[model samples]
Target: MTETRHPMTGNEMSPESAGGMERHAYDVVVVGAGGAGLRAAIAAHDAGARVAVVCKSLLGKAHTVMAEGGIAAAMGNRWPEDNWEVHFRDTMRGGKMLNHWRMAQLHAQQAPERVMELEDWGALFDRTDDGLISQRDFGGHRYARLAHVGDRTGLEMIRTLQQRTVQLGIDVFMELTVTDLFQDDGRISGAFGYWRETGRFVLFEAPAVILATGGIGKSFKVTSNSWEYTGDGHALALRAGASLINMEFVQFHPTGMVWPPSVKGLLVTESVRGDGGVLKNSEGTRFMFDYIPDFFRAETADTEEEADRWYDDKKNNRRPPELLPRDEVARAINSEIKAGRGTPHGGIYLDIASRRTPEFIRKRLPSMYHQFKELADVDITAEPMEIGPTCHYVMGGVEVDPDTQESAVTGLYAVGECSGGMHGSNRLGGNSLGDLLVFGKLAGEAATAYATGLGRARPAVAEDDLRAASHSAVAPFEVEGGDNPYAIQSDLQQSMNDLVGIIRTAGELERSLVEIEALKERARSMAVEGHRQYNPGWHLALDLRNMLLVSESIARAALAREESRGGHTRDDFPQTDHEVWGRKNLVVSLDAAGTGVELSERPLPEMPDELKKYFDEPRKES
Candidate 1:
């Protein structure tokens, strides 16, 4: 495709017109109104600091609401033998031990409390007969560790936080998308963004900033994430000189709907498998038994009877191979498909219809039933669902202290999927919600404490910077003639999916870089026709900036790793290069290239003996 330049004019507020800008000062500014952002705002408010929660979307509709799997926590309900140590081990093993030990430990220890706090705040989760929150088994968890409210755990969690936030009267700036972080004297002062409703620039000057802006799945062709998962926080933090870690590890969900070209690939939630669904190829074979590693061999079932029995009695029988960690399941399906065992649709069938009755399927997997019926025109109740892998979560993000949730950039903090080293290379299913709750609270507490210690020295928000950022954010719409933003976005997604997806080789990574550069050039000339109210064109244009930045980071980091581990697999360098690569993390920073964004390496924090003790062996059932 030829690159086209569109004639454009700046929105009335150019940098030259605004001589000086007015600043609104707050003690803390939390960017992103998702679960982490809301939690941070509430914590900051409770810590006696004036706080503001800024989001690009409506208050209740942040990407957190889209999460379907349950939150992982060691609540010790059904299995009294389970504890934080076992949870910690499972997390590390699932992540391929690339995770920071302390972070994993802290997350496991605090997750139960965080889930309980959500319950206290009026969040209703499906309950056990004993009246505690109900738990279910998810991939990578040794026990039934995920506390859930059916499959809509994130909806319940976010709604509870949103309602609680309203009651607390925390200042919320909804429909405002933060374009840039304004820094003063090497510390983060605040952020500057534009209002999508009015196309006006708003300035927030605060001592502390929390980035909970979620994941980067939108950069790929297919994803489980919503439009908001554009790596905004990651991009903004990178531009402001914060270090990002583990950009190479992107998780490909094992079951996204395949076939329709228009709806593309929509995520079929993993909760289906958690509820007893099995993955089968067209030949009707239980394929995962062929892919089990020696490490998991003892626990995984090889026969249908054993698998069914395991579900009923997890303690006495072997676990189902279908419930292996996401990475394992994805690779198994990939292998089967590659060997010509795939269905006619170029994907395998996830059959829950045969395992359970239609009534049971409808009640348990309601969203799955609804999504397939509405989008794919298939009722999962009678027929097996066609599913395949799609890019989903990034195990890597801005590196932070496991205890404080403070990034290397003194005044900047990150929580949720934007922060790295928690899940390491491959995240365990159901653990993401728990990670958000645990670290969101930590980040909020840390930011509030940092703000409190600073007294009241709010820095100035420069008019020139605000105007420049606002124009950059809205420039795509101003382009009168050029490639459509949606077109460029689709191209970018395809490039990422084709070249930088599930399996990577050096040649493909090189091709992806070239393709990305060309796509980015096209993005600069993108045009939009609609006015700004709920304009998807405007949203895609803004999201493209984040997607480009994150995609580049992922490709560069993947190129540097030179080894296969967890979510990052190299066709050429097929083995894990632990001798050189294991000791250090591939850290991407803006300073390394003199372009204000750079990539380098940093040593992983040494695991203390206290924390390492948990990894001695898999917890034995007493």
Candidate 2:
């Protein structure tokens, strides 16, 4: 074996037995190649930073591509009355007033510009009759606000961002998994990981690291997320001394496929409803009218006729209850299923076929049309879809500075779904894509500024820390008669799905914590039979560490928040407590021993008196 010295740290490094080793140095190292990551890389590179984007999956395959609806922005192309202040109010109210005020303000104000920027970079969104980028209505928005390309807006976004990154010559390291973030003197030093194909060790020596690794949906048994979203970014940030908030508020998108065991939990985008689809019970009754909450009753239509008329004459009628915030919709569906009013396959019906003609459905929702036809042998254009809530997004993530996107740990930044406080208790549909663009650019710029300010002198990765990361990566292969990682993962998913899922209770959450601990114990001796190369079992074993930590955080946070608000619904504490739980958010961090997590309460920042006026009176749109 040949020993080589790291140029920056002067540390002796040798290839581990499992695979060859490679080292790279950059000013900013970005983890995850999703929309947020690519957008960040572009911003950093444009700012003249030597940036590298590392992802577990190939370029263009990030979870962002799975987004079907549209990017939320107050472009006002479709609704002349729509603007940033209204958008901000909708976001804050949609999140149950738990969102970071400054973040929400920035997001709503900047989102329109970001969407326009994408158009300048070659994104081809569907246009309106007058020939401007068309906006579509979605949950929680007062106007048609989402700038989209039919039901494949996310695909267009990734394509546009990826193209921009390539044109800028930013280096992208695809199919690489980052297992650990190394910090020196409480600041980010670099990141360590391995190539997925060969399992060869790779080191990124950088002054700044930005995590945009999407959500924790894969931790649930039923989810719209792909396998790559194992909560790596959340767990990595926590272990690196950053804190996470809102972990309990997991968004179960109200419409996931609930038929054909093979395709259960697949996303049925809210755009279906935005484009006129309606939900019905097995009795063919539009049940959303019966479930409209008092809070939304002022704006939501209580009658089916008014709801249907509002689609064409928004100025005259209240919006449909079907377009309520995701949390409300998901809970309503869960209640319907529990009451035995569900379809034969155990879900409610989303019927656009009856509301829209086949030609119109195909024109507006091409992807949903093909997705159902190809995956489940169902024709969405002809019949209603059997749909239920599925674990879709985690509003909780690494807590960061609202302006800079910098985490508690210096030189470490997080954006998009990996960062918290923006969405609060729940996120509005279409706002996610907007958050990625607005904050992705902000994080990239801030990280670049921090990195370049360090000049030639930068923090160095410790040799011992590097060795420990390598050992942890290979430990599963050396264990004797150890536990199965897949089995542990399966049990953890089931426990989370049944206990800490869409609705929660103190008893169930406490039980979930116990189960998580038990799984963590089993994971200690997780074993794999094959060599690191092409070993999925080993990959899963490694991912289990992240999933366990995130799971614990979610359960612990869920138990701490005793009030039902937004995505966190508790049967024991069913009412929102404005004086207590609503005033603060539970923040999670690694305990002193670094073996477990500890929770603390952080007070929500007050919104300025000027901005507060937007919510003081309800303005009727004309």
Candidate 3:
């Protein structure tokens, strides 16, 4: 194969490109440099395959770094009874049993080993008294199962993975956003993207592509996600003929800063509650006990006394109502606010000050301490935090094979928050981190095998496709006197937040679809000012397409699933229909005309008797 080296930039040029654009060739290309992307790259390299990791932001700055709750793994360090089977059960039940059984099974069985691997690679987690890795309690698990470093577990995990990636000489393309995926026939051939800083086009010619881009929380008006979570990977996969599953189930985290306009939607980690904080209403009443759902009643404590005691004696007492799954807690908080019992800022209070000592709070929750002190000027050790629900995680993404993390489209893989079905309807706290590591490794190795299996017969990206992608990427700059991308984005966010948020109705979902259609029309005429060189306006314009497509998917899927379950709560349906909705998973793909979204249903994969017995057996309290 002959390649030309560009004059100014040291990038290779593909012979098919008449316009000598920057190009790279690798066995596997991994998009999004978060935990899953980094882990995938490492795994691919270990399998003796050339790998490239592409990121939308600077290295080590993906949303994975914002994960403060910890990595969930049944290490059994805190409670000797904890194991993968218990974890598997907790995960399935927490997700409202909508999870892909095999994915959940694989995650539960491999998470502990992944955590140990991270530790072996230089992650310094908090230690137990016996010199073992200490574990902390999170929402759904029976035992203390999260391995963490205070409130900075994600930071440590990213640091370790980033270091390992660098040490192994895996190539990483930072600040490059993939706009489209190239497919030769029905198989992935390459990826097309541009550098964020310079706006120069770049292409990765590879037989396999792994999408690890995180969630789509930014589509909402109030979200804990950063600017980069615009559903890029989800849209790319859908446009490439890969179906998305469970798009309706979007997690609204119960605790996000609701005071001070500037930091309203910032995340307040679940670690606060796991470490002994409690939720209270404006009347200073511990209100979580009153809102416990019937589904979790048997395992959850009914009274504050038992709930408080369970923190110390997990073997004898039930878990606290405050530690219920996120969907339950978020809905409960919303109920309090709607019932006129909320604080002045339209949120309830999360108080750790009254429950734990100041020293302990600072040590276990240093980030929360500083985040509150610096952002809100409310010392978390002395005063309660005013927080409300914020759009957090998306439990929906590209449909992929549970064993390999490969999508329906050949040679295309997805993992992390971009891949669906691991968390069913709602995700348990701390599972995100573990999901990243476990599936990332699986996808990386599988993509490598697929790439290497082709031997000398690799697919090539076409010149006409490259030209079309380039024209599309630069179209916003050509429009004059058109709609502002920022204004359209803001309107889209408002529409989603009001019509398709934590609670939804058929009427609202229908209205949202209508609004989204109008927004798509406006997005077509979106114009950006100035050249693409480091222009934020142009970037936002490009990202709007992805956000709109994903938002529509969520609205359409939510409208079809006329039942309340986990993250996809329908106020109209009001109850979970375990018979119909529970048995089928909603899928979203481009219509036959390749214009609008088409929604369909597929039966949930049956779990074999051997694995199904875990759920049927008696609940193990210990």
Highest TM-score among the candidates is held by which one? 3
Clashing pairs in 3: none
Query: Which digits, one per residue and each the tens of the lDDT, describe model 3 over residues 1-622?
Result: 6667644334456774436567889999999999999999999999989898999998899899889989999988988788898899999999999999999999999999999999999999999999999898888877889999999999999999999998987887888899989989889999999988889899899999999999898899999999999999999999999999999999999999998989989999999999999999999999998888887898899988888888766666589988999999999999999999999989999999998999999999999999999999999999999999999999999999999999999999999999999999999999999999999999999999999999999888998999999999999999999999999999999999999999999999999999999999999998988987989999999999999999999999999999999998899899999998989999999888665698999999999999899888876554
Which ten contiguous residues of candidate 2 have the minimum total lDDT? Answer: 9-18
Computed on alpha carbons, the lDDT of every model, listed in order, comes to: 0.83, 0.92, 0.93
Candidate 3 Cα outliers beyond 4 Å, as residue runs = 1-19
**lDDT score, candidate 3, position 69:** 83
Model 2 regions lying over 4 Å from their true place: 1-20
Per-residue lDDT of candidate 2, residues 1-622 (tens digit):
6767644234445554224567778899999988889989999998889998999999999999888899999999988889999999999999999999999999999999999999999999999999999999999998899999999999999999999988887888888899999988988999999988889888888989999999998889999999999999999999999999999899999999988989899999999999999999999999999889898888888888888888876765488999999999999999999999999999999999988999999999998999899988889889999999999999999999999999999999999999999999999999999999999999999999999999878899999999999998999999989999989999999999999999898999999999999999999988899897998999999999999999999999899988999999999999999998878989999999887899999888988999999889767656
**lDDT by residue for model 1 over 1-622, one digit each (tens)?**
3322211111123342344432456788899888888888888888888888888888899888767878899999878877998899999989888889888999999999999999999988887899878898888888888888877888889999999999988877777888888877778887887677756566777878999999999888778788888899898888888889999999988888886756556777888988899999989987888888766887778788889987766755467888888888988898888899998878899998888889988877788899889888888888899998888789988888888888877779999989999998899988888888888888888888988897756556666777777677767778989778788888888889888988899999989888887877887788877776767778778878788888988998898889988899898987777788877888988655423245788787888888777767554654
Clashes of 1: 4
Candidate 3 is scored at a TM of 0.98
RMSD of each: 6.0, 3.1, 1.8
Q: Considering lDDT, where higher is better, how would the candidates rank from best to worst?
A: 3, 2, 1
**Top model by lDDT, which number?**
3
